[model samples]
Target: MIIAAYNAQDTLVRAVNSALGQQVPVEVLIIDDASSDDTPRVAEGLTRLHDNVRLIVSAENGGPSVARNRGLAEAQGEWIAILDADDAFLPGRLQRMTGVARRHEADLVADNLLFFDWQAQAVAGRALRLADDHVQQVGAADFVGQCMTGRSPFDYGQLKPIFRRRFLHARGLRYPPHLRHGEDFAFVLDWLLAGARFMLMGEGLYLFTQRIGSISSDSSGQSRTILNLQAMRDHTLGLLARPRIRADRALAGLLSKRADAIRDQAIWNRAYPHLRARRPGALLMEMLRDRRSWPMLARHLVRRHRARMLAR
Candidate 1:
């Protein structure tokens, strides 16, 4: 398991412990993102005790995506699992995940995750429980489409997913180190789009802490989230524009749905108690306003019209 941290002094140990306490033997690589805090000293101490635990201290501060990319580059495990600094894993997280990976021969395996409050209280339990029939062996193209279209639940909690290092390397996959918010979405969505064998383990093995000062908890600038969403939108559209990737109907459908998902999210971030306050229609129109987006929006409208005709 690879754990990435950015000045996560208070929570780093707990995150590392999660991987060490696992029932099976595992190595925990901790990447401290040039933290100004005592994270370096803290990590060094932890390494002395647990041989499976190692530390990668960055010379300069980089974002979480870069930190994870660094760890991904150095990871020796065939199966790579990511544990964030503020998040902890269940006791048997790795054992269960590796077991599923082997059994299914999947390139990627993700389980459900739960969130905890700052005081270590459970805020939400058993989140992302895939339906009983949610297990799927979709083609590579199909998987990407589902991710882009919001047909599947892929969120920050996906940090817990175990990835096949060989497969990821083969596809030249790495997180985009620039963006903060949409980095994971960009990375995971692209992998799915590239047609990886993605499997959901249907177990909850991650504990996401929602502390007040945490990045996830911070809804800082209204524009910050917008930039993140825009990055995701642009990345998806670029992929959709590819002739080969779009030739697959599943991938095309996914691109269209993901665009709507992005536009829908823009409307939702605003608090609106009335229909007039919501801009879903306007957002859809704005998405279509872009000449690049018109084709995707048109295809969606066409599909809806066909479905309506069939109903009539």
Candidate 2:
């Protein structure tokens, strides 16, 4: 298991322990992304406490993508499991996910996630619904469609799956370092676009904690997230433009829809600064061009009106 941590001192120990506690034999690799907090010290302490744990402190901060790629290069395991420093694996996560991969003959597999809302102190039983007790193979078109429409609980941005190292190495796949946020979404989409035999099980094996101060929580962070998503959408569209990807008409169409969905979101984000400057007319026009954008714009307007009323 590989964990990329940045300023996660409070949760780092628990995350490391969870990885170590897996039912299957596991080695933990903690990559500290030049954190200014006590994360490096905690990681170093973990290395001393367990022989299977190794800590690598990055000299410069390169974000999660760079840190994860660094861990991928040094990983010795056949299957790679990623654990965010703030998130953890439930018991038997490794054993069950690996077993499902072997049984289904799948190259990559992910299960449902359990969400723990730290601020709200609430928890969701499962992130996705189980179709059945059986493992289901996810098609490229279906995966892309779900991601584009939000019709399904499965999200490449959040679902942390176990990957086949050999398959990844064969494809020369690694997280795109240029993306500051939403890197996981692009990585998974890349695999799907490359025709990876992806599998999904209904079991919730990973606990995803949603807390304040995390990368995706605030306004500035969310702006970056949307922008990164836009970049990935553009990247996918570029690939779809090629004859190779375009040959698959079904997949090409799905990719186009996904790209359009992301473009709408990018437009929404771009309108934020203008909206702040009381330039609502242009923003309204942008939202009107895309039907999907109307709902988002309405919500924003509703929230602003509520705040103003409360202030009054």
Work out the TM-score per prediction: 0.73, 0.80
lDDT by residue for model 1 (105-198), tens: 8888777766555542444444454653344554555444445432243443234568899989999999887766566656776677666777
lDDT of predicted model 1: 0.66
What's the count of clashing pairs in each model shown? 3, 0
Could you tell me how far off, in angstroms, the CA of residue 229 lies in candidate 1 after the best superposition? 2.1
With candidate 1 superimposed using the best TM-score fit, by how many Å does residue 184's alpha carbon deviate from the native?
2.7
Model 1 segments more than 4 A misplaced: 131-135, 138-159, 193-195, 211-227, 270-312
The alpha-carbon RMSD values of the candidates against the true structure, listed in the order shown, are 8.4, 5.9
Best by TM-score, which number? 2
Task: Find the number of clashing residue pairs for candidate 1.
Answer: 3
**Highest lDDT scorer:** 2
